[model samples]
Target: MNELYKVDTQDPVGEVWLLSDFQNMRTELCEGERCIYPNDLTKTLFHKDLPRFPLLVKYICANDWLSVQVHPDDELAKSLEGDPWGKNECWYFLQKGRIAAGITRQEKPLEDLRNGDLRILTPERGDLACLQAGTVHSLGPGSKVIEIQQASDMTYRIYDWGRGRELHLDKARVATKAAASAIVIEEMRKFDWKYFSIELTKKVEGSGIVITLSEVPELHVLIDDREEFSEEALLVRPGSFWSELL
Candidate 1:
């Protein structure tokens, strides 16, 4: 799927980290030489105590099937794993097909291990799904997506389609619960929360003027949906950035 993400994987494309302080293999552009963490801008944008970027931005392409997995919340992660953060994410569908997220109701022990009343959906382009921490979910085939989540890699893979990966059933059973949410098929006003927030703008006129008021970093994406959806992203620091359309 070179069109969306520049990858050539036949299997489910696990992750493509665009910008990260702690997880990227690609080095940052430093002193006219390409080195790790090219941007010292993380500290300038976010909390001084945070070692790296608090958010992990990625694009995932699931050509085939993905494993049913759950991520722990912050408290559990800190207590059990001693990790700093947990993953809470939102997905934007590029080329959508099927997806299984959460369940009809939270079942004790999650019987038969992955075949409980799972909510299946077929969402088209421009659809959004907000998956909070502890949500059990899976990305089905033919789905190309952009995901924004907390910068943590502790995914408890619960069920793996008999692919023979290790399963964390005990943790999954405890992490997951019956959660209700609707697929947002229309234009979003904004997704505001304690962790992160997002706003999708359509036909964004000529340019964008972003004014940053607080310490938190702001991610601005200008998507041109005229012919094909071509996007340019700018990480707005603690000040203002006036973008010019080329």
Candidate 2:
């Protein structure tokens, strides 16, 4: 792990929050003698009515299969959880691995998927998988990935591989969408989604304006692309930012 996120662990660490504003577990930033958390920083960088930071970025190291889970969309999130954002996430793989994404067919029952039958996708290093809300998915073993998503942490787990962890099958059934699935992208340098944009590059040639809901936006950059990726992040006012080689 990078010293920025280093931790003492007896068991394998599943995930690291690189930039998150989730309560209690939020990441912090320091400027000279001042230190602030992302949630508090949002109040100054965004509208006063803004509930929280709009993005969550993480580094996940999956030693075992993750829960077969689904997330609610913005509409469902508002009605079900009374939250402002829904999770629409993407994974940039740093290690070759497999993942289960959506149902194999429209007729495949969600119950059958709970028993471990799923459509598997093998993604190579440098591949990106964009997963919109309601996509039933699971990360397979040995996947080292960078995940960027909407700020919400609402996950409805469908299955847990007999780990005996609580399964949110009822909520997951409501959240699962037959049409939702992972869109695996390869050789793509840039991604512009509804909430944010991401670029994977060794070089950035020019200046760019980051268009987002917030007038001022924060950019999370993953530096030194290796096993344990490092981070270089900055907050830009009026949503403008510069680009250069990492």
Candidate 3:
């Protein structure tokens, strides 16, 4: 059975963490915190049954901007880096504002990222974006939402907006290459179903992809099929399940 786990908040950014123990999501709250996977149950289940958990869900908050980052795929992570986990994530904006996301340069060669001339894109509220494994991306100031994908925490930071702090340049460069190697941005298409599905609109600027979807309670269930059941939803408030629904 699927279960909802509350996310613990962490520092640097404010966010609530929700994870299933089966997924072993460590960072309960706060943004930029790493979610650990291969939870005890997933580990045991994999050993016993071989195939069990398929995906991981995360709640992210970005009061301030996050480090520019990317993630590796499973094969690259395992064979090249020897890391067991790699990231593949998609974002659904729950609450939005003047937020930033996606890579800055569209036509520039990946090598330019090394020269550090890449630009950044700032998206408005109600935007949706997909970050396939290894896509260089970051969350801008004042953004919060849910991220769903494979369970992994391997990230590569490419840039930090001259905040004047010590940065992980070495790892960021390595991760940038990994992300650049597997970059893929398909135009966002709208859902055709009229009775239930929400419409999606997308555009591409520079090298980044931007998307906008309708913001309404009716659209919530369209993001995830499991959201329909009150028991399966993540209650952000003490009685949010009953109150929000009512």
Candidate 4:
């Protein structure tokens, strides 16, 4: 995707944050002919007490297996990491491939199942995999996806496939659940998720990604002709969003 999009980077580009509003990393939001950073639009776009944007969008391109990880829910997030939000993400596959999601057998120890002891699911292009918080998952090699999730990035890495990275087994053990739910594959269209809702469409031409807020008068659109991803998302307001595919 980096080569296809002509993005120049010194290191391998694993993830591209399309829309974000964290304190350290922020994406510009365009309203009409004006463009402003999301952090600066809090007065008009967010409530006075809200900390950050409600949703996050990213383009993930993996050539190898990603870390097997899990995320905490709202209660766990606040108690463990002092974060206001937890990550409950969905992946919209751009390329047909496989993914390691959920444990294959319920009785096996999670530590013993760290090395690829998970169910392998094959999802074709345009299929969406909804992964709620605490669901253990890993993206397979040669898979590209558009990820939509809560604004937080609280990931607890259970395994790194012998990368020697620090493991969070203790926290992961507490956050892990035997059978929260299985990943569901469905066609991408409109999704009314717990944290946020998304509506997808295809565009022949015009802007790169346009986000229209349903309740607010303001419209935030991301315009970048250089971006050539198969699909990209636009975050409207909290609990509402719009996505487009080129």
Superior by TM-score: candidate 1 or candidate 3: 1
Per-candidate Cα RMSD to the true structure, in Å, reads 8.5, 8.0, 12.8, 7.4
Q: Work out the TM-score per prediction.
A: 0.71, 0.77, 0.50, 0.77
* Ten contiguous residues with the weakest lDDT in model 4: 237-246
Instruction: Please give the CA lDDT of all the candidate structures.
Output: 0.58, 0.67, 0.42, 0.67
Give a tens-digit lDDT track for model 1, residues 20-64.
Answer: 656435335343464435235444444254545566666677866
Error of 2 at 82 (Å): 0.9
Please give, for residues 1-246, the per-residue lDDT of candidate 4 as tens digits: 567556788877788777788776888766579777755644344334456755677778898899988889877988999887677888877778678888767677666665357778888876888887888888898787777777787888988889898888888888887676446567666666645655554342332234321211122343332332244433323342212100
lDDT of 2 by residue, 1-246 (tens): 433246666665677776777778777766578667766645344434367766677777788889899999877888889886578888877769778887866676675674245678889977889999999999999887777777788998877888888878788888888777899988546666655566654333333212121112234321122221133222212121111101
Better of 3 and 4 by lDDT: 4
Model 1: weakest 10-residue lDDT segment is: 237-246
Report, for all candidates in order, the number of backbone clashes.
Answer: 3, 0, 14, 0
Error of 4 at 50 (Å): 1.3
Q: Could you tell me how far off, in angstroms, the CA of residue 57 lies in candidate 1 after the best superposition?
A: 1.1
Model 1 residue runs over 4 Å out of place are 2-14, 23-39, 105-108, 180-185, 201-246
